[model samples]
Target: MKPISFIWILSVWMSLDFIMHGASTDPFDFDQVIHFKIEIPDAGIEILRQSNFQRRWPDSSHRPKVKAEVRINDEPFKDVSVRLKGAAGSFRSIDSKPALTINLDSHIKDQQFEGYDKFYLNNSVQDRSYCNEIICRELFQRAGIPTPRATHATVELNGRDLGLYVMIEGFNKKWLKRHFDQIGGNLYDSGFLKDIHANLTVNVGKNPEDHSAKNNLIAAVYEKDLSKLLPGIMRHLDLDMFLTHVALDTLTWNWDGYAMKPNNYRLYHNLDTGKFQFIPHGMDQMFQNPQGSIYPRFRGVTVLSLMRLPAMQQQYFKRMLHLYGTVFKPKQLVNRVDQLAAVIEPELKKRSLREWDRNQRGIQRLKDSIGARGDFLGWELSAPERALKFPDAGFVSIRNWKTSRLRGDIQFRNANENNKQVLVIESGSGINIGRWYSQQLLTQGTYRFEARVRCENVVAAPNDLYGGVRVRASGSRINAVLTGTRNWTWVAADFLVSQPVEEVELSCEFRGMQGRTWFEEGSLRLVKLR
Candidate 1:
């Protein structure tokens, strides 16, 4: 009847950690491997501010100085020494000096993972976590990308063991903050934006008509022209090198890499030398999204999306193919896959068989219970193909709306008779037409609706003809409208049903009679909200 105590839990957890970190027969003992750490002095902050102030676009100021220590059996190795080297710059207000230098023995026993062990040691696969930015940065540099240099070390204390330390070059902050300010602070909403140290004055310009609360702040410090600084930054970047990194990122399922928001990229400018550069930093949560997801699909850059933007996407893709091709053979991707799988599989297998069996069994049981009821009802991937070819057919058919084309033929096929389709007619006299129909109805709930549409030589003003998927409950309705230029685009909207209705309706309304519009494939499926 006694309650569990915190110390008791800690003891049990430590016992498990011991088992996981036990010595292995393999030549390399991953358990004993001590990743590196870095520490930045307060003076280093000023140098980072001045150098990166304007150039570090989309990022915040404050680059912590990094240092790595080597460890064996949880003890620092005293005999080993360490030194840091890279691009030179002022550490305080003085002239530029070596990036960093420190004696490992001077701070051996003091180094530890600090507050991160809970997430890294407890929430990791195989009891391993690349919780260290030093390791991530090293991988980036070795991949031939323009990354800051990183160094490792070993240190020892009087009665303890050896440990590892890592050091990495810091980035400019002034440049990054400027960009964030220019973009209206929307960049902060992204998961990629981190380490927000200070706040800047909010500046809203004269024109309030075209700005939102978000844009005002960023536009205040926005640089109108970036081309002037692109050249110098490109010199160090090697577009090919950066693109190669992106490609490897995709192959590795490095979801974290692609998870960046548009604002995370920084643009550096050396005013004295008239040089400009683009730099990528912050890899703390790198290498996520190894495979695709089924739910609200993981948001990140993908080969598919990249390929869609033929011009810019093609250039980046070719660079990746070319660079990766030079270093690895055609079969190298397969080999790399095997190597990564070998590294991760053993740990995952053990967890699946021992630690996660209960959870896995519960998920499997739930899946079986749902059975055919869980099948997804929505638009097919091939709907685009059918839409492009037919050009005037409803991908999803709703009942009741009349289809009359002053220009093209439109067809509606109904899978169920109870859904309503309404069309709106707009004329110069402010007159509109509305149609109503009814059939069998399903219970009100959240549903996934999708439509593939194309506009052909359509001339319409913003208030003119617009087509969309609509959901209605009682007499109230919510519509997700698709209105833009005469091009194909996908639009989605989430709607909630607060009341019960006997039928569903799909309606298109025309604000004016003079405009023309076309509809292709459309579909909707009712789904239970979790």
Candidate 2:
């Protein structure tokens, strides 16, 4: 064979091999930013506008697909379905811009562009930084949780510029493939699973109709055999993964997820392991402020139930500390923000000067968060076991307290013929419950809660209604209940605060009783040992 012929043949073979076996485009490669355009037809835009009214009026609400053209880096693509998306944050039906969902398959046959079948073009109407979802999703992915990737896009409809938008990866079968080897399995979109017991919507799976996995998981959570609950949960669920996911959400303060409410997450019955896994979704809001605690105190029932166990709680705190040290690095995260901003800033400037200025400030604020958030959380993780000591009587005077009833009278009057004053609760049908609250979240400790109380004619409204003081720990409910009637009585309890923010709130209640009650010398003394 001639040398020139041999060289040409070898080059051809190498090019073919590269085309066949080369890696797919990395969806989350943060160095480069993506700019995409959505060109919806005029009729489609009108339908979207009309759909807004129908969305508000459920009677007329119907999801109708409309064809849209897309351009990626000036590369035109045809046939994408654009639809309005969102529940609460679905504002701007006409102008502010409603969140959008684009189905790529709507235009191309069996098309999987950039390894993603569908994409979510969030208007980001609520986010000031316009990168909360992007940064938070990155945080979760870094912490080993399966989450979506985000980038900024330039959106257009009917030749009209719609400004910059955050293009998010949709949570679907493609997401499952990216996260798990077992692609074809039961995938449930636990979308707004307000009640865990209720059935979850099957988003993508072989047995799309099978809800057995979610049902069994819920049953295990409410299992009667408390001793077997942990083992039972471990059987079908990935506890460590779920806990880490929760910790990531907490660390980022993504309240819209399972921590604040059992929503914005997905459950996948992985075929590879035959076990269910929890994945996070919907992260438009995060790092809003540095005020709230990183630990959610297991506010949701899913975590609440498991965290009640000592072993689970220990593992959670351990994982949290580990993640804090290794994954939640402030400098690296801030660098990521700066990198994304660098790519996005130039395009953002093309939109408008005012927008560029506003977005830059927001980006800087996010960068500031990246610098400061780690230390804030580190302080929380390594918080000392300090004594929540109290002052002498009346020294901790009322910061403030409010009653549930719209119309209730609180009067200061002398009681027991003494000069000491007491807060008197008097009403026709409601009872006087002198409720005192602490100003700050209670940390781990033993608290000595005491109050002087007296009630007259405490009605038995229910099976057994009584006037009492209720102490609620952060992770649990109503640890102790104190009651008194017809005469002066000392209501007190020794509260155990095992979790941070354990003494989150205090409540004094007189359930469905029509009577008068007086309270004085309320004290929440921390009990400590020498």
Candidate 3:
């Protein structure tokens, strides 16, 4: 489709183009309210409402779409297809008011609102304040990321008001062209992928039939040499933008982002620079869990790898502190929240008013976060902090043997607790994964190793089989193999440490897809047996 095939399809679409663009960067001006009305056919209404009860997380291509007429302000465009969007968010199982992606181009082919063929309306069910999506996006845009512009709307469907909703500018070529100098490139949607996997879905771009750009990225990820890895990726990625993106992600405490998982992000390969940039999405739950360190060191492979370098860590912290001070202003933000609430106040339902009131009381919450994040991060990165000291067999720091090829992601939870050391394992690809060994050294002797492990949703294909923690020493292993699913069970093994190994590897190794396990606590006692 040609860019600018349509512009200002709805009068409301015009105001969303940032009427206050240069005049003033005020976050919200409630004086200008965009009203949206959608009239769906009875059959289409049934399909849309059916999604309210349907429990499934499918790709947008697989989502059920029905024809409807969407009216922005006074104009009505007919025969649009509306369907649920997002992974868990799309599922009505959790939210009866599921998020929607309306596709006007799908039906009319020639019809589009502005240049956007599609648009996103997210249910602000989680955000009682109904301002996080808007707040975070504005922050990202000001920070120079190609992020969506969000504004609240009073949405009515078939004369039934749906209450307060945040309408996000759809991610497409037209939107990209607006934010970027170069717009022609592949846009890969991360659907439900919490990490960069070989099976990631392609939203837009070349099929990679010959595996051109994606292959180079995968090769960089698996490249063992740190020197070569960064340089290799630098060729295909905008590193500065990536760092800024990572800094912003951690600073905003978006645990659901690419840093923490492989989900809620889009990859745009800029053919201009011959590099890819990560565009942020799913900002509804910003600052949901803020107690976490500003540095998400244990998260995404990209962030983790970058943080591993001293210089990159310094650079990340610098950008984080700068953004916290500059882009994020607590008083200004709270004012924006108030402005948004005030403008949309007339459109709010009475029940929503109560929630909005309740949410407004916590305007101080975000303000407090804004005020604290700078100092908090400053103190965190001010000095070289030492890793927490765990008990003798307290905690384990695990890494894959291949490092580059395939490996399991190991993270220790509650390392300070004496009774138990919980480790969460997100199994990586391939079978020959390295052990999750301890950092401390082990003596030459026989030892009894036991751990309490619980497997949840441990999925495996016919050929794939694995899971469980074991004690390894003297080239021998006493381990428990985990598969299918189970509750907390003790997995024990005895092994002789004939040679004094630098580390006692308590290996809970698993390979294949869709597997998650928790290693709660373990004990290593030197056997007195002669």
Candidate 4:
């Protein structure tokens, strides 16, 4: 054979061999294999003031009904069972209730796809239908926490494989009536859940004119005017319940819980007494640790998003921290972590073995599609240390300001280079370095502002060492000047707003002087004065 022909034939043979036997490498597919569609219609439930109902007839009001259409892989399963549950099982069984099933084999064929056989189970055992959800709730309850009962269903498809679905009872009228009768009417409106215009048209609210008519029981309670009711309601709610869930949630960094909309959180209210309760619900454990920061699936937006709105941001952070502290007391938090570790250890062992077998089967089925173990499925346990700490408050940034040139050099700098960064107010002439001072704004009353200011040796003028932070509100500006100081010192001032101001600006203005200056650890707070 000619040399060229021999080489060509050899190359072809090598190509065939490589195609026949090559190392398979690919990433795991995290995409869902089965699709789920949930339909929650309006007009199925009604909410009322817990104090309106008469005593001794708590069960008189009718319970709200729910219906859902579930589809998997474009096929509908008829004869699938559905389950429901609530705070009380004695009045009525919320488990394994029967539901109507519709077969969708014809529908799939109509769509030009392979036909599939599906079954529906409406009446299902609460324990079986929502096994995982029940376990989570049970764990919280065992830890003396408050959580709604988990109701679930299991469906048999083709008499071979099984699928699961869970249904959680809403803290609607029925649940609230029972609890409210026991406790006197005391409730506060939940800021997180409020009434919407659309819910009103659906008759979700008891009264037509009440702005809070469609608000969930939790929100209603939160919005309640009586201050006395809050303490009792908060007392009844198992703080331990919240802590257990939060601890588990922190471990998983459940982002999904944060993503749920207003009505998702379960609430309780009594028509007779007008009392209220709120509880967290509906969680699917999925999280992503980005930049070593655990981002739960439910926390759709970043923490920075809240910081943009200064007033709301301050209130939100303060409220969140207070709640966290209330639920997880220092000693209690440590103990809860130990309990969680105990639970997770055993579960982890079982999961390791099961996951290994599943991975093998999945690899065989997909062939080269199984990627790195940590690539898409590994769970993160701890977040970076910095993420666990509190973030600083300051005028983060400003644009198109009157003193843009003088304030141009002002930038944020890290105090410790390893710790959090602080705003660096650079020294320049004829420019006022302004920061949109973000402290809690008073809706009604007087407030005092104070800060510690220091002058460095690099400052050019000693007599002209005149620079002060200004507090501006509604066309009124109060200036507190710092003078005759070559080192860090404290400066204070007071301001009165005849009317409410949504926000206030804090600025350091340098008049007719140029040199470097350092400002650090600035603070502004609001206090009510008689």
Top of the candidates by TM-score: 2
Q: Report every candidate's CA lDDT.
A: 0.33, 0.66, 0.63, 0.35
Per-residue lDDT for 321-377 in model 3, tens only?
677668866567667777776766666546476756766655556556655654565
Kindly indicate the candidate among 3 and 4 with the higher TM-score: 3
Better of 3 and 4 by lDDT: 3
lDDT score, residue 145, model 3?
85
TM-score pick, better of 1 and 3:
3
lDDT of 1 by residue, 89-158 (tens): 2122212222333334334543322211101111121112213243344445556554543333322322
What is the overall TM-score of model 1 with all chains considered together? 0.32
Worst 10 residues of 1 by lDDT: 115-124
The residue pairs that clash in candidate 3, if any, are 6-114, 193-262, 194-261, 194-262, 195-262, 401-434, 467-482
For residue 498, model 2's alpha carbon misses the true position, in angstroms, by 2.8
**Residue 524 error for model 4, in Å?**
14
On the 0 to 100 scale, the lDDT of residue 134 in model 3 is 83
User: In candidate 4, how many Å is residue 172 off?
Assistant: 10
For candidate 2, which ten residues in a row score worst on lDDT?
521-530
All candidates in order of TM-score, best leading: 2, 3, 4, 1
Instruction: Enumerate clash totals for all models, in the order shown.
Output: 51, 1, 7, 57
Taking the tens digit of each residue's C-alpha lDDT, what string does model 4 give over 1-530?
64568888899888876675443311001111233343323322121111122224433433343433445444443322222222221122221232323233333332211222222233222222122343444444544444544433333322322333343333333333433445323222222223221221211234435534224323423433444333433433332333344444543234344222332243333344243333545443222332222222223121222222344333433333444344323234334333433333343334365633443343232221112212222222111221112225422222222222345344333253224233334454444343433433333235445544554423334454344433333433445554334565555445554322234443434432334444444343333332
